[model samples]
Target chain A: MSLAATAATATAAAERGFLSPTGVEITFVLVGLVTLGAAMVTVTTRQLVHAALWLVMALGGLAVEYLLLTAEFIAWVQVLIYIGSVVVLLLFGLMLTKAPIGRSPDADSGNRPVALAVALAAAAALVWVVVDAFRTTWIGLDGPAQGSTEVSGRFLFRNWVLPFEALSVLLLAALVGAIALSRKNGGAAKNGGAAKVDRTAKVDSAADEDSGTPGASGKEQR
Target chain B: MHLAYPAVLAALLFCTGLYGVLARRNAILVLMSVELMLNAVNLNLVAFDVWIRDTLHAGQALTLFVIAIAAAEIGIGLAIVLMVYRNRGSSDVDRLRDTAERAEPDAPAAEKAEVIA
Candidate 1:
């Protein structure tokens, strides 16, 4: 009896049974719930600013989830990019668009019922499929950190260097496009204004290209 | 850890984003929903990377790439939204119907006549 008990215990330990719930798993679930709740509130909130704030919470919770998953570099990058810049950009967008400070009631469209039904159906199908597929799958997080800085840097530079450079180029292109879109149609307004607009566009693109790509690429180090 | 947790979470999050995208009237809110969807994809990528432990670490690499792409997308999206708001004085997605088909019988004929002229 004693020998069998010892054998069973060892086997269970080797198996890393997750039904019992490891510490990491528990933390992950708890954080996931918070993240989901925040996300729900973000989409459902009446106040525009509140929605953006709730988005910050949801995204910050995701960053924590990344940390829990042992992707420390990605976690920090998420915080830096999503929380730091993206949320701020969204807030700026809200303010620039003149979103109401208080409740504006028409936040949701007329097709909300249809939207909810579609989302529910999608969720059900996706959950069923994912759970069925990954029911027995397990992630063994026992060894050295898989997503540490050195490891990410190694694979990033060794294999993904070309794509990394290409992404930076893409970012540069996006910046130029943004400048083009945001600049007023000065040319259409006044013919002489076209030269003025061209010079300003050049300056704006140069400034953005000089400062923006590096900040994004620095954290987005793939 | 069981792979179902992150997978399920990501699926739900993506669905929530989908609902937001379809339901939200404000273009900025729609953009927010898009970000949520992208984040869900990133989570799924990271979880799968951790699960498979690929020699190339393709999942995490792709996650980073997705993040970068998402950033670029948001910038361009916001710029477009801003220009739309400036032009039309409102950022409501449903209100923008410049390209929508007209229900009137003569509208198409009139358009064709203009084209012919």
Candidate 2:
């Protein structure tokens, strides 16, 4: 090509700036906003169960944001693990602890102003740092998708197989630990079998009271 | 497509989780807040992975590991919290401050008297 033709093409390409906002970018921003709102609600709600449900909304919005970013695999994983499993686990914790179904007085400490101030300060600092660091960077959507499952799976197995396997072991340990911690050992006693029977009877009465009045029994113990 | 957008969103989410951790009294709520923070970190990883155009996808791989770790953490944390509630009848963080028992005001004097006797 001639020098003038080469210069013309370079100028045209330069004019097509990478940071130009498009429909996808607009949608991304909108979804991010919704996710932020949901997250805020998740943390601020007084009802523990409602907070868990709002967490689902926040996580779902994040999954949508991931999809918009062309990360389909991570998005689905977010759905399956976060929305499906994690939230359910949280709900189970709430139920197992007999947490109050309505507004919980203990949900918020008397430090809202302080917490809000700290949160705002930290958020501002983080936003400033990230924006300054990546002021003009953009991802090209025309290339091969970077977050496909096959590519991620290959990358994970090739370079990160050790950590992946270690994570499974950690999960197994956590399962064992959870069961051990939550089990009611009615038969183990320091003072022999008679003491064990007494302890079991007391525990059974407490359980009956808890069943009759849910969280009220816990409150009375205080 | 701007990296800053997702990065800033993640930051905001993180700060919200921080506030929840610091200000909430319920251990379960605190655990939920921790999940929020982890999700924020995941968002940051994915955002950077896309921006860097990393062929190896190291960022996403780390994010997967993080998710697995988070699941494990929640499992154990909830178990401990449930155990605490079962024993104490309440999961309030403020109420679980009996880790170190305080000496009674008269304990030292009583001990000295016993020794002298």
Candidate 3:
């Protein structure tokens, strides 16, 4: 082959390699951008409830990213656990605390600039480290999907069973501890005064009212 | 595809969460920030799992454990925050500085005893 033809072929091959983004990669980038935006809103929103809602979006986007990455099981688990349960739990906590439904000026501190600076520095360092470490690595898409439930389950049960059981215990302990902590300040408050108890009960009822009409109605039914 | 995309995304998410943790006063928001960080870690784990091509899927298994731990953490954290709000009427971490106040009254007596001893 002529040198000119050889150079042209080589250039064509390089162009083909560089310019083609697989559908999965494009989807990944789009989902990542969406997730990032949602995360930003979750952090910066003035409304506490809105932040929680935005968090749902962020978590949901992560699930979609997982799906695009071909981790269907992990994606579903992310959806089921993080979005379905955790966000609801957070909303419950919000209601239980009687956090304002609208804008919460106290949500943000005066340290935003400092925090931003630190965050930017940290992010830069992390990205640099990760990209530098794995610059040329490519995930094989043609092989048996490594992220399936069966593979993950086998891996978890076979090798990680002990830690998995330990996690169950930890979860149980956390559940009990949470119940203990959030239970009414019974004995401590009883020592104060009947009037004080009544005032607290009234405040609790008022907070419940602010949560929603259903909660208020439930209290009345009780 | 390179692993850098997801890794960098995770880094950004983690940094945003860190900023939220540092800049937010609301205890619940802080917990949310913590969730963000945990999610970022999960992303990194899965990305690395795929990049390294571990047949055992060890990274995803660990990610599962991390998720479980995160759930537990949030449960206990939100509970503690609720208890604090119940007692103090606000979830602002700044206002909870008085927790050490109760121990302050005994400090002087202890110091005096120490000096005498």
Candidate 4:
């Protein structure tokens, strides 16, 4: 390519926010910072439900980053699945458990020095590997053209049908497993007779309700 | 022969997420860390798909599948954890060390003390 043509290509890349241009560069930097901050909070938070919410922020930041890169479909999937479904399921679990809304002494570990050392070692190794692998290449902002839904749909049905079917079967098995696990067999065995079972069931059910309902204190904070 | 900006960012995100997975003990926090790692992988796949200019768009298509699987995994994992907590009253990682810890006759009187220690 000629010098002028190369310069024009660079300008176009910069305009698209993929390069270090003035207008779009700041946006990418800000988004990256926000994403990192949210991720840090997600890991560090003591409250399980609050951590899940922070995860929503982190995932949403990722989706925003995807949109900036012009991958609209992936961004929407991130929001729909991560924010809409996954985090909600997590909250449902937290609510069902007897974990107190206030701090749980069991939430943190005493052996943090070991965990931190392992984590730091893992992070350092990964950074080194990544830097070594992608040191010289400069990828441009222009992306592929075949990212529309139709193309993806066709590929899913035609080439990758078996793995897709397997995933469905896995989901069904998980549903059955969840039902079996939560069936209250222990309470039934403890009762041995019907009336005792009924009383025990009531007590268990009351506990469940007390935990599941967010309560007045929680509602006020929210 | 060059790494794209998205690919580099994805690598960083994934590595940090991996560290979180290794470090976090809370089951819910572990799930969130796993989600972060998945998102990082998704970013790399999408970036590479765009850079290569392939006709199939395989990377983007696979990312959609990854999102679906992640949702199911989190749902089922949390449900299991909740059930476990209902049975045992706690989700602490070290609680698994003793088989008789939750509701067993073999549990000692000082089991709680031992757990705390």
- Once fitted onto the true fold, the runs of candidate 3 whose alpha carbons sit more than 4 angstroms away are A1-19, A184-222, B99-117
Compared with the true structure, what per-residue lDDT tens digits does model 1 show for residues A1-222? 645644544454557665688999999999999999999999989899999999999999999998888888899989999999888999999998789999989999889999999999999999999988877666767778889989899989999999999999999999899888877432222322332344333332333432443344445543
Instruction: State candidate 1's TM-score.
Output: 0.82
Tens-digit lDDT track of model 2 for A28-69: 888888888988998899899999999999999999988887
Which stretches in model 2 have alpha-carbon errors above 4 Å?
Answer: A1-20, A184-222, B100-117
For each candidate in turn, the TM-score is: 0.82, 0.79, 0.79, 0.73
Q: What is the TM-score of chain A in candidate 4?
A: 0.67
Q: For all candidates, state DockQ relative to the true structure.
A: 0.41, 0.39, 0.35, 0.38
Which stretches of model 1 miss by more than 4 angstroms? A1-18, A186-222, B104-117
Candidate 4 deviant stretches above 4 angstroms: A1-26, A143-146, A184-222, B1-4, B99-113
| Per-candidate TM-score, chain A | 0.77, 0.74, 0.75, 0.67
| Model 4 RMSD vs true structure | 9.3
In angstroms, give how far residue A5 of model 4 lies from its true place.
Answer: 17
lDDT of 3 by residue, B83-111 (tens): 66654456877544422333456577673
Report the lDDT tens digits of candidate 1 across residue range B30-67: 99999999999999999989876776889889999999
The DockQ-based order of candidates, best leading, equals: 1, 2, 4, 3
Question: Best DockQ goes to which candidate?
Answer: 1
Interface RMSD of each: 8.3, 7.1, 7.2, 6.3
| Candidate 2: residue A91 lDDT (0-100) | 98
Q: Tally clashing residue pairs in candidate 1.
A: 0
